[model samples]
Target: MSSLTVAYAVAFYVAAAVLVLGLVVKIKQYATTPSPLKIPTMPAPRTRLGVVLRILREVIYFESLFKSNKWIWICAVLFHAGLWLVLARHLRYFIEPVWFWVVLVQPFGIYAGFAMIAGLVALWARRIVVNRVRYISGPSDHLMLALLVGIGFSGMMLRFVERTDIIAVKAFFLGLLRFDLQPLPAEMPLLVHLGLVITLMIVFPFSKLLHVPGVFFSPSRAQVDDAREKRHLAPWAAKLDAERDSAAAE
Candidate 1:
């Protein structure tokens, strides 16, 4: 393998390792953290099953976001929905004999890229134009949006303007999975798209993009409104109570 191929292969391997391990550590932290109070949002579910259903709706439909702001919800849903389709379509690259469902959605994924870009652009504009949002926005926020926009644009260019050897691209990714390196296409657009993707992966666990997993860990969404029915005590708090009772008995 050429040095360029080796470099890209190493880069991808390192990025994947960081992304996976970083997320695992963060998720473990989230799981172990204690919430000592029942602080679910108003109109929250009461039962565990209800909480599960509510979380599902929140994840799949962005129900809370929809209720909070229609325009933001629209843009977010469009981008996320498009991203889902695009990612599913990409499964073709990793596996031999692409799944039937992937083949079915292949065409839609192409157009979904446009929706993703449009939504991202609108969201970035909102951060700039809306004074309230702009006040809270930081450099990282703008940079993340810029990175996604760059990724989308470069990917679109590859599809429409200057097509690269997609077959080689698939081979490269499949090779990565099989522990056999393959030559990656040297197209500028493909390189830019890949670099941005790797950057996104590296920063994802630490950045606001952690909202992907953070949503599930959020007390407001994950907790049930059961303070009235039962005592809500964290493990540490419960242990303290037990110690207090033992001391009183002594």
Candidate 2:
């Protein structure tokens, strides 16, 4: 394998490690941090089952966003939906015997690439075009959008413009899985797309992208509205109460 291929392979392994370890650490923190109150958002779910359903709605449909801003929600839907299809299609490169569903998705994933970029462009424009949004938007927000757009655009270019040997691409990824390095196609579009993807993966845990997992752990969304029916207490608070009772008895 060329030094470039070897370097890319190492980079991919390191990026994957960072992404996975970072997510695990962040998730553990989210799990252990105590929620000290019964502060569910008003008009929240009254039961555990209801809370689960509500969270599902929020994740799948962006319920709150849809209610607040239809245009932003539309862009989010297009991006998320297209990105999922594209990811599913990418299974072909990793899997030895590609699944039937992945095969079926190949054609659609090509078109979904466009939708992903279109949504990204609209979202980036919103950050720049809207006064309130632009006021609140930080540099990192724009950078993340640019990274995603570059990924999508370069990927489309690989498909339509500078065609590379996709068979070699698949071999490279498969070899990585098998602990054997393979020659990667050193094409410009492929390099740019992959570099951006690696960067995204490395930064994802520390970035706004944490919202993907963080949403599930949010207090207002995860908590059931049962404060009226039952008293709510955090673990630490409950422990303090128990210690107080023991001391009073002694």
Candidate 3:
């Protein structure tokens, strides 16, 4: 096995561990964080089921963003939709027998890559050009955008410009799952693409990208708008109230 193969295999293992464990930890924190007040945004759902559907709509369609800004919403949808398709297409590399849906998606994945890049470019440009967005833009935001663009660009190059042995590439990832090390092509474009991917996975849990999961736990969206009809008390506050009632009864 080439040194590149061994190094990348190790890197994959570490990145996967960090990605999984970090997400678990952060999501736990989000879940456990208490909301002591009913602070749902206006026009919020009154029932639990309605809240769930509202969250679903928000997640799938970026409903609030659409209402707020059309341009940003368009870019977000293009990037996110393309990303989902590309991810589904990538399952061929990981699965032994690719799913029928994945095989069907392979053709569109290439075009989706272009959309993904375009959306990212537009979003990044907004941060640079728009006075309000540019004023609040931080280094980390720009860095994240640059990294994603680099990953997408390098991936396109590997697919179109510097063609490598894709069979070997798939085998390498499959081997990682089976605990067998397969030879990874050391083509410079391939290596660069893989390196950026690994970096993204490792940093994902700590980055603003974590909004992917954090959205589900957002108090404003998750909370029901029934405060007038029902009292809302956090766990700790309820426990303290119970103790007070018992003391007064004694």
Candidate 4:
């Protein structure tokens, strides 16, 4: 019940609220935006089921990224795969009885942290070294990468260089979930990692990180290539057509 604990607890709760609410609002907007054109990328799926499968492949395998650039794809895949494993392993901290699968992945998660850092570094380097990418890169892009790299490096330091009281960390998080604030460990590395994580959560909804959810709503990816087979009309356009017909009849 120290002031530090209270501050962190409040920060985390506020960050979580912002993250969830922001994503909800953004997703609603994406869903409601009408696409009046059947403009899927070339070689796109013709059927709805096929589009679903295509999107799955894009999400799971980064198919388009792979086709576009091999090195970038490799780095992205490594980072994302490592991130998933690390996140799954973190379930041990939040849940009471750790799931068997989470327990099984615990060891791999440690190594995954290394891979995540490596991939992030490579990606950042690409933004700096590649002229085309660097030209388009802005301050926010670099800052985002720095933030993620800081998070991964601090987390790795906590695990390898200076081990903290993980039990206390788990208790803190679990307490937060139950509306009970517990004292967070005062370890510098752990504090840095947690702070960065909270910052990421708060900024995620407004940042390019939104591409995670935005991908699903992309008209180019979500729409089926049926322009040839049927007329495509937005909801507003359809309403206009209906009004026009009514006026003509009158």
lDDT of each: 0.92, 0.93, 0.94, 0.92
Please give the lDDT score at residue 115 for candidate 2: 91
**Tens digit of lDDT per residue, candidate 4, span 1-250?**
8888898999999999999999999999999989876778888899999999989999999999999999999999889998998898889999988999999999999999989989999999999999999999999999999999999999889888999999999999999999988899887888899999999999999999999999899888988888878898898789889999999999
TM-score versus the correct structure, for each prediction: 0.96, 0.95, 0.95, 0.95
Off by over 4 Å in 2: 243-250
Q: C-alpha displacement of 134 in model 4, angstroms?
A: 1.0
Candidate whose lDDT is highest: 3
lDDT of 1 by residue, 203-226 (tens): 988899889889999998899888
On a 0 to 1 TM-score scale, where does candidate 1 land against the true structure?
0.96
Taking the tens digit of each residue's C-alpha lDDT, what string does model 3 give over 113-186?
Answer: 99999999999999999999999999999999999999999989988999999999999999999999999988
- Summed backbone clashes in each candidate are 0, 0, 0, 0
Q: Which 10 residues in a row give candidate 2 its minimum summed lDDT?
A: 227-236
TM-score of candidate 3 versus the correct structure, residues matched by position: 0.95
Candidate 1 residue 195 C-alpha distance from true site, Å: 0.8
Worst 10 residues of 3 by lDDT: 82-91
Model 1 error, position 242 (Å): 3.3
Q: Which stretches of candidate 4 lie over 4 Å from their true place?
A: 228-231, 242-250
Off by over 4 Å in 3: 239-250
Supply candidate 3's per-residue lDDT for 239.
Answer: 86
How should the candidates be ordered by lDDT, best one leading? 3, 2, 4, 1
